[model samples]
Each structure stands twice: as structure tokens, then as C-alpha cells.
Target: MRWDGVHIAATGVWLPGRLSAEEAVAAGAYDADEHAANRIVSVAAAETEADGGPSAPEMAVRAARTALRRAGAAAERVSAVFHSHVWFQGADMWTPASYVADRTAGSGVPAFGLQQSCNAGVSSLELGARHLEVGGAVLLTTADRFSGPSFDRWRCERGLVYGDAGTALVLSSVGGFARLLSTSTAVDNSLEAISRPASPVADPSEARRPLDLSALADDYVRANGDPRRLTLRTAQVADASVRQALADADTRMEDVSRVVLNATGRSRMRWQLELQLGLNEKMSNWEFCSEAGHLGAGDHFAGLDDLVRSGQVLPGDRVLLVGGGTGYSCTSAVVEITESAHRPE
Candidate 1:
């Protein structure tokens, strides 16, 4: 939907130490062949829970503090907190959104969790933008730690390496460095089986086992037959969303200074950048994504934060943000930098 007065007050990102792909390969944790094919230079790696690293929600709190500090007085107006995630958030059946809200926005503010897979970040942005229409600021946060016993960050998926990071964005109607022009979303629920197991598991324990996305995808292909039709549909909805978002913003692709997309591997990213968007890596935030890896639902916000902090974007520059998730949902947004002083504190 098109937005008028909504703005991105501030953004904050908390990234853990890095682990080079080469190191993972040398340590036998990563397949050398897969590393060569993916070309993901490095990924943010968090320490194990036993090593005292912050949990996913805790990292969100740290990022929220940074954003709240940057927002200054604007933070006081936040009326709700929306936390997004993909993997297990430290505990089952517990509300991570409430934990984040208490640590950041404090109690009494309505808190909600969005589990729309990787698209939740952009979905949260759209939701927050809508909430801003009702007269208050909204806090959007996404965090995920793709580490060990439960998930093998390196081997759990094909074409993507998971990362550990927390990202936050504050939206306000008052003032900010960037103006939110528009956001759009499209979905194709028929593609959901690509990420689902071949059959439902009756045992609760078996159902909660570690994910093998590569296997799941293979099974889906085998059961569904040729995947070319589904791939075409995916590209169609993604491209349509981007086109509609730009149109709603009253801008064109040429007007956008940068594009932020899902942080998948080279091949998948190429499909989005070259085939779907008709743009190359130079026109997008692929450099940041290549190093950080896929940060679950945090890619778009973290990429926007990096662009703003690094001063790669200047005043009046327009940025296009696109996100897609396994549930076969796509969301696109347009943001225009209204100031040149968005550097980190």
C-alpha cells in the first residue's frame, strides 16, 4: 500500500563475529564443493548458548536499544512491537515478542510475533507502516541464530548459508532520515509444498526434528513433477510486486539508487537480480549480503541499516526493498533517503 507520512526513524543491527567460508570448509563443517558453488565469503556466527552468547530475543533487545538510542525522543512514541523470526526462538510456546517488548518498548505496549518465514521482515515493515496511520510509532525487530544442535547453519539448506544477526527498524509519523513511499505484497500458496515435508508426521518429536530443506525440495519436485511452472510463477509474483511497489511510489526502477533482496546464494540471488528484477549485483546490496549470508527475516532491515550507516546512499536517493519466503509470499517496498546524516553513532 502507498504511504504518505510514514518514515523510518532509525535502524539498528547487532551482528556477531564472522566465520569465513574458508574456515568452515577447512574445519570440515562445510562442503568445499558447495562452498565453491555458493561463493559466500563469510557469515556472521554466534557463539553457542553454553558459551554465553545472547539468545535471539536478547540480541533483538540489544539492537532495539541501539535503535531507540538513535531515535532519541521518537522512541517514546512507540505503541507496539512486532518481532519476526524463522527458526526456534530459544524456547517453545513462550512469547519472544513480549520479552522483546518489555526490554525495549516496556510493558503495556501491544506486542506481536510474526512467523511469515523470511518475508516477515518486510511484512512487519508494512504492518508497522499501517499502524503509523493510527497515530503512533511502531517498532519492528527480526532476529535468528542459525547455530548447532538444532540447526546446522551450513548444511541445513542448499544455496544459502544461515547467519546470526538481529535487526530493528523504527517507523514514525513525526520525522526521520528516510520516507516510506510504498509497500506491496503478493502470494502463491500453491508453492507452499516446496518447503514442506512430503507427508505429515504423526509423532511430535519427529515433526520437530531438524530441517533438511534440500531434501524437502527434492521430495516436492518428485511428487509435484516438473518445477519449471512453479519457478515461473514465483518469478511472476515477485516481479509483479516490485513493479506495483514502484508504481505506487510514483517512481521507476531507474529512479532507485539501490535494491535490497533476500540474501540467498549466488544462483538464487542471480535469479532475482538478473532474471526477475533485470538488475545486476552492482545495482543491489549483494556485497553486504554475500558477507552476512541469509539473515532469515532480517536481511532487508540490516541491508538498509548498512547502506545508511556506510553512507552509500545519499539524500534524495530511492531504495527498493524486496523480500520472499518459503511460504511463497513476496513483499516489495520503496524508501527514499531524506537526509545525508544517517551514520551510526
Candidate 2:
């Protein structure tokens, strides 16, 4: 799955506005003392191209525009679109995958979307890179709004961390950015219950639909408990995927100058790399999620953007991109830096 001559051409991110963790709790987003309280994480409070709701096609399009501009590609020039599924409490599935295509003006680039919760961003890019190998540019965009009514909305505090944002990466075989090098995927369906959305927005009967976590508390607890079975399985699968991805790229972890782990926060931040991935404690410096918040499916891309913009990355350095989804799907991508672009970093 590795490629020696591949590289990433550009990365762009769009954040609507900040919603402090305290403000979110004051507004009654979640319990004051709950572990997973939706205490403000990063939220896109402005006018998103997608409008921050179910079927957020416009939002996805906006992110795409930024990324394409970064890579100097025009919307009309894009041939394919890959997006991560969006979640808004009480709304679901009304918009089809084709919705993104329509907003991009059906400019001939087909569209596909992933609803794999957290893992959707990486998975979408993996597929988009494959399209790039065919000698064309592929637009890969990820957008999420955890501010919706769903209890799965982001949670945070001084003791916790959260966030929201959208990201766009222009991937192509033409030139620029980091080469995708390789991607690895591992699945443990046994841990499937760890996270999920109970009902689609289409369900007409209110009773047939789950309006809030009040009714599904039991299910949520069983699925995401303190003794998180998903966390353990994720560690195993993610570690395996990282090793394999690096091996595919003919590299090693020590060789990875930059590592982006899903939003590093209080509870999970300190030991996330060591306890979960069996890695050394030094990686805490590059953690991106917590400061960025959970970002729904936008986790990895946003983190990657930060790295590029901060001048934290350098040419010839290998970057590790990793994370997972609700179904326990995890992925690792190895990228080699080639351009500076002055990204701040």
C-alpha cells in the first residue's frame, strides 16, 4: 500500500467559531458532572457551506473549495468528490450521496460519503488517493458539526477536551503535497456496539425514533462504558494498522518525524499513545484532537492541517495519520513531506 514517489499536495481547514466548554454546559448541552458531557469542544458557529445539519452538502463544498484553492485546483476542474457523513440530532439520510455532487455543480465529479463516525475522514482520503493514482486530482473533504441535538455531540472541560471543524485535502497524482505512500485498515466488528446512531431522521413516528439520550442511556452506557471495550480493541487494531502502514512504506515509527493522534484531551491524552498504542510518551507534543475537539469524522484531517500550517512538518519527514470509527474500523496512513508552502510551519 506504500508508494515511494507519492506526496500530499495541499491541506485546508474551516472552523466556524469557538464555543467554550463552559458556555456549552451553561446552555444545557450536557450534564455538568457527566464523564462524556458535551462541554464545548470546537464548534463551527458561523454560516457553514453545509449549514451545520444533516446532509450538510454546502458545508462540505466550502471545505472542498478551500482545499482546492490551496492546491490551486478549481471546482470545475475536480473529477471526483469524497466526503465524510454528517450527523445532526433528529435529522438523517434525507440527503443522498449525490447531494454533494449536485452542490459541486455535478461538474462530472461523482461523489461518495462515509458514515463511519470518527474513521470516516481517513477512510475517505484512502479511497480518494486511489482515484488519484489514475492520473487525476481527487477532492477529499470532511465536515462535521457536533453541536447538534444528539448526545453524541462533543463534550469537554478543564478536565476534558472537545472541538468541531471541517477539512479539505486536494489529492492527486499531478504534483505537490505529500505522497499517500500507503494506508492500512483493521476491523474488529466484535466491538461494534461502542458507538452508533440509533435511528435515521426518516423515521416518521416520534416514538419509533430516538429523540435524545434520555431514552437510550442504557444502550449508550452498554456501548460506551468506563471500561471501554472499544478503546482496548481500538488500541490493538490501530497499533497493527500503524505498523503495517509504515512497513508498507518501508519505514518505522522512530522515522516518523510527525504523528497526529485523534484530538488529544485530558482523560485520554496523557496515556493515549502509551497505554493505547504501546508507544513512548513523547508523542503528546503532536496530539491534535482535544485542542481540535472530537471533530466527529473530521479528526485526522484537521490535525494534519495544523501540522502543515504550523511549520511543524518538514521535507523528507514521514508523517503518521491514524484513527478509527464506531464500527471499530481503524486506519494508518504514512505520508512523506516534500513541500514547505510556508504553511506557518
Candidate 3:
């Protein structure tokens, strides 16, 4: 009745209607030709689709199925599911996890949802790693739709950098990729002053509503009070979380090789890490988030995909994941690339 080593077996991702960085810039939403842009970025605008329902569960199910299929694992093999949806794709109704389970091909599996905002992926990963007592492959899904309610609200730097995305990662009971050596999530609630400043539809008294995209363009203009302060505080905790998670994993900063930071833009990401993580020396960023914009909960998982694709993560290579969510939660995870994960491109 104990969770041993938690390993990532496979990863699956779904990008919205594809858009190039050039398109994003031309659209006046972002600048693709910006200096120091990661050559690896190709923006994706996740278009809302009819999946029998407009719900986070539907989006997550699509992603989960893809990831599990890539891993060659049946839905029934999934012992648990962790679903993270930051923005309200669906209105406040029931927890989206239940719908995912109901739609999951597997007849009887359990799923839980976490509200760590951008850090939801890593937080969910940590949860699956601990649910070893459940004793089965854990399929984690992170799916978010930032466009709805802010579809055209890109006038702001933060909103402009947002893109729609969904990612699925599977962890095996026997362990797969790199074991979840340890995890650290730090929250500076005092700095909760910053935010995208949108009203959430979650009604504690009512079942979660279905996904609504009518307000997509409206929410983006709702800028938070202090973007600068929020960014600064985010970097602060990211730095501390890195050190703490590294220590917990029994590893050292010097020993760490690759780092995946999913901050929205290159400039903001660079500033955050340097001023916060204290990495003024040298480092490589997969930078998937920039061109794609911020993919809500999918940032870290999607970033990991970039790391692997860019060859930053080869078998036996150690990679670090750092997440800075809106709630001011900082999370870090150490991952090792596995041969199986080095799937044929």
C-alpha cells in the first residue's frame, strides 16, 4: 500500500489550430521575430471543438487518450487520472475529473483534479507519484483553453502570450522515465495581489458548468493590477523551489543539466530566471511556451516535450521542470529521459 518510484512512461500533446510565430506577430498578438526567440517555437491556437460536450473533461479525455495510445497502454490500465484545467473552459459545475473518468475507455478508474493554476501539471504529477498505494499506471492530463473569454484579449503582454494546449503524461508503477525523486511547491500568498483579473465561474454550491467560449475576447483585456510585481514574486519562488526540490531529490544545482521554464515570453522568462532563479551564468530553454503562448496548465508538460525534442533530454540525462502559476505557486521536478521516451520521430 505504498507508492514507490513514480516514473513518466509517455507523453502526448494536442495543439490547437496551428499558427506560426510569424502568424502570431502578424496578427499583432505577439512578436515572432523578437530577439533571442527560441527557433523551436511554432504557435498553436487551440480551437474549441465539439467533443459531445463543451467541458474540460472532454478536452482532457482527448489528450489522455492520445497519450495512453502513444504509450501502448489501454485506458483500463490507468489506475488513476489527474486533470488540471486552469481557465474555465467549462462553467462551474462538477469537478471535471469525474467526466473524464466517465468518458475514459476504462470502465472503472479514479481521477482527481488540482487547482494549482500553471503549476497544476507538476502538482498532479507529484500526486500520482504518491498514489502508489493505488498500484496502477497513473495517467495525468493537463488541458486548458485560454482563448475563450479572452480570445482576442492579447493587448496585454500576458494575454498575448497565451495559447491553447493539452498534454498527457503516463507514470508507471514500477517507474519509467525519471523517478519523481521529490517535489516542492511554494506559495507566496502575500503576493497574491497580481492576477489576470478575471472572474472565475466555479460555484461551490453548484455543479461545474460546461465550457463556454463566448467571452474569449472579453477576459484578456481584464489585466491584473501589477504585472511587474507579480512577475518578480513569481521568479522569487521559482528560484527557491528549484533549490528545495533539488535538495529533496538529493541532487545539486551544479549537477542539473537541462531546465524547462514555461514562463510566457522570452524576455519575461529570461528576467524571471536571472533575477529569481539566479541563473545569470548560462542555460538552454526549449521555449515552447513563447511561440505557443502560455498553455495554462499544459505549460510544464508541453515544455518537457520541447526539452525532449530539442535533444536537451537524452536517455540518462537529468532535466529540471520549473512552474510559476498565477496563484504564485512555484513547483519543481527532476526528470531523467528514458530510451522508450526517446520515441522514433
lDDT order of candidates, best first?
1, 3, 2
Q: What TM-score would every model get versus the actual structure?
A: 0.97, 0.80, 0.78
- Highest TM-score: give the candidate number: 1
Q: Candidate 1 — what's its lDDT? A: 0.90
Write down the lDDT that model 2 would get.
Answer: 0.63
Assess the local accuracy of residue 59 in candidate 3 as a C-alpha lDDT between 0 and 100: 66
Model 3: per-residue lDDT, tens digit, 216-238? 32343244455455456666787
| lDDT of every model, 2 decimals | 0.90, 0.63, 0.65
Q: What is the per-residue lDDT of model 2 for residues 1-345, given as tens digits with 9 covering 90 to 100?
A: 765444466777777656555565678864566435322244444433366443245556666667766776433356777777546522465544456566653645687766776788887767776776666677777765554333344332223344446677777766776778888888888665443345544554444332343334346566567645545666788878888998998887778886766654545655666665556645543344433566667767777777777777877877888877657788889888788766431
Off-target runs (Cα >4 Å) in candidate 3 are 1-4, 20-42, 50-56, 72-76, 105-107, 148-153, 156-160, 196-233, 278-282, 309-311
lDDT of 1 by residue, 1-345 (tens): 889999899999999989999999999998888888788999998897899899999989999998988887779999999999999898879999999999999999999999889999998989999888887799999999987766888998888899999999999999889999999999998889888877788875886346778888888888887889778888888888998999999998989899999898887788778887888888888888889999999999999999988988999999999999988999999999998755536
Quantify how close model 3 is to the true structure by its C-alpha RMSD in Å: 5.7
Pairs of colliding residues, candidate 1: none
Which one is best on lDDT? 1
Error of 3 at 226 (Å): 9.8
